[model samples]
Target: MEHRDVGILHPGAMGARVAAQAVTTGAAVWWLPQGRSAASRERARAYGLRSAAGIRELAATCEVVLSVCPPAAALDVAGQVAAAGFRGVYVDANAVSPERMAEITGVFEGGAVTVVDGGITGPPPREPGRTRLYLSGDDTAVARVWALFDGTALTPVALAGPVGRASALKLSFAAYNKISYAVAAHACALADGHGVLDDLLELAQLMLPGTPLAELEHLAAAGPRAWRWGPEMSEIAQACRGVGAPSGFAEAAAATFGRWEAHKDDPAVTGQRLIADLVQGSSSST
Candidate 1:
């Protein structure tokens, strides 16, 4: 299949790798360097992505543009694309509530652009079997997006529904996947309070054999990304409430993740530090 030109909205950690996969497929992946940090420019360069002069150029040039930034900026990114007269397929692959996803779709209503709903599960595609990208929308558009990563490390699955299905699936899965990490972190805190944290984790491994809870390192690593996950947990809560499901756990998980937001991208965040932040309801780093 002939690959089309693709534009990645922002080349952060996940977006850069995703763009690299598109590049590997012989597609020209573009990113706008204006207003991006030095790290983003370096990542884009490392991934072999072509640089667009600006958002307007990116919007007008690429046949497809994928938005992989923070959930809070999804709408704004869509608005910018819409305002810039982008008439191609726009894939929103951010972690967001279905309602928010619909809002993003609505941004392109009556426009020439085709909005595709996408939800990326798992981490950045460093290797096979670690990440999956869920897409739902017009079958042809989904197929087009699917083909972009068909042979890459990131697996793309087309859902059998409308625009919101992919986002709903993403938030639903994340509600459990991420909140469980928060729960385990708290468990670590509780156990440590009584001087039995290691023993508790030992037992936790038996109960959650294949899960991240089975290892303290996994839970510790979760803390540094709390800045990203906190908003996602809130989005999960909003998603649950939209579907008439209980949202208390998701809401609490959001708050729990907030306590560790100060540790965003900090490599030094440890299991004990996460517990301390939770126990104090704030990060000591603050």
Candidate 2:
């Protein structure tokens, strides 16, 4: 296999891991450090990703660019890449609505860039078979992206259909996975309010096997990512509306997650505080 030059547009937690996988495959992965936080820089350096001076440099150098950012920023990031004269295979692996994904693809239409829709499901790729990176687009583009991670820690699956298929699949799964966590947090809050918190956990242990309710603290653990998950839930809501499905559940879950936005990346957000935040309908608690 020929060595490929790949660019990672801002290596956050997930992006860093994905780039590291590319590095393991002998791909020279590039990242932009300008304006990125200290933690992002640390991750990029630790993962052995070469730093590009700017988006233009990254665009000018790499044969492929993979985007793994917050859902709301997906379009903006794509637009930046398009503006930077990127003319390669661009993989957007953000959790976003298919409609939003289509808009992102449109940003590069009539250009040299081949836009590959990528939707990541499961945790960050620490090992093989633990995560799936679903790709959909031109068959060649999908295959190209698939080749980047084949036999690596990230399992890339090629999907048949247009660019939006992977996004649809991702949102469809997140709509249930994320919203169910939010709903479980709400239930915990409700029980706490009624002084039955202990009782609910006892009952959940007996009846809610293999569910979020059974592992109550895991829901609180979600707080660190709620800032991004909030927008992801809204994207899922948009997807539901686009399909003529009821969007209420997703909308409500978005609001539920919004209350934890301030806790982004804060490790100290405990289950007790998470339930209290829900009960108060705010994240202002210290």
Candidate 3:
């Protein structure tokens, strides 16, 4: 694959890693820092991404632009890129429902842009073989996007479907993976409320063994990231409802994650403290 110029819109944690991986493919990765926070600027500098004058310039120059932002901001980013006269392939890798994904595609309609639906599963691609970027849309466009990841730490998997199919797959997978974390946190909270936390942990160790115990650690680690997961859980709920599936659990998971808002980005928060807060209905106090 020939080297291509790629633009990464708003390089947050995952986006910064993606930009770095794109750099390994010999692509000149550009990021616009006009309105970004200081931390975002620092991240872009650390990742060695080239600075673009603005979104319009980034969109005008890059062969492909990747939007790896929060689901709520995905449409806005796509609209801005489209308005900037971007004619290249636009890849949206946000954790949104299929409905929202289609809406994003619609935003680029009538523009010279070709939309590629992408869903990223797994953490940042700091290590090879740990992350997969699932792509769907026009076959040729998907192939073009896939080629950009060649020889990079991120693995690209092409899916046989139209736009929104990739987002569906992503939300379906996240529905279970993230909801389980909420379930574990809720279970521990309930047990703690009943003064049976130790008993429940013992029972889980004897019955389910390693995984259940590990979830406790996962719950603790998720505290700082819960703000993001809350929106994702809500997106899962929307995806479920779109298909006439029961969305109660996902809605509850959203609420469960919302409880951790106070601890969002706080490194000092612990699993025990989160559980206790849940049981006491005092998560906001944190």
Best by TM-score: 2
lDDT of 3 by residue, 225-262 (tens): 78888998888989999999999998998888888889
Model 1, position 88, has a per-residue lDDT of 86
Model 1, 1-286: lDDT tens digits are 5767899988789999998988888899999899888989899888899989988898888999999998888899999999999998999999999899889999999998888999999989988888999999999999999999998999999999899999999988888788999888878888888999889878878887866567877888887788889889888889989989999999988888889888888887787788888777778773
| Candidate that would win on lDDT | 2
Candidate 1 clashes: the total is 0
The alpha-carbon deviation from the true structure for residue 94 of candidate 2, after best TM-score superposition, in angstroms, is 0.6
What's the lDDT for residue 150 in model 2?
90
Q: RMSD in angstroms, candidate 1?
A: 1.6
The better candidate by TM-score, 1 or 3, is: 1
> Which of the two, 1 or 3, has more lDDT?
1
The local distance difference test score of model 3 is 0.86
> Candidate 2 lDDT (Cα, whole model)?
0.89
lDDT of 2 by residue, 79-187 (tens): 9999999999999999989899889989998999999999999988998898999999999988988988999999999999998999999988888888888888888
Model 2 alpha-carbon drift over 4 Å, by segment = none
Q: Which stretches of candidate 3 lie over 4 Å from their true place?
A: 210-215
- Compared with the true structure, model 3 gives a TM-score of 0.94
Model 3, residue 221: what's the lDDT? 77
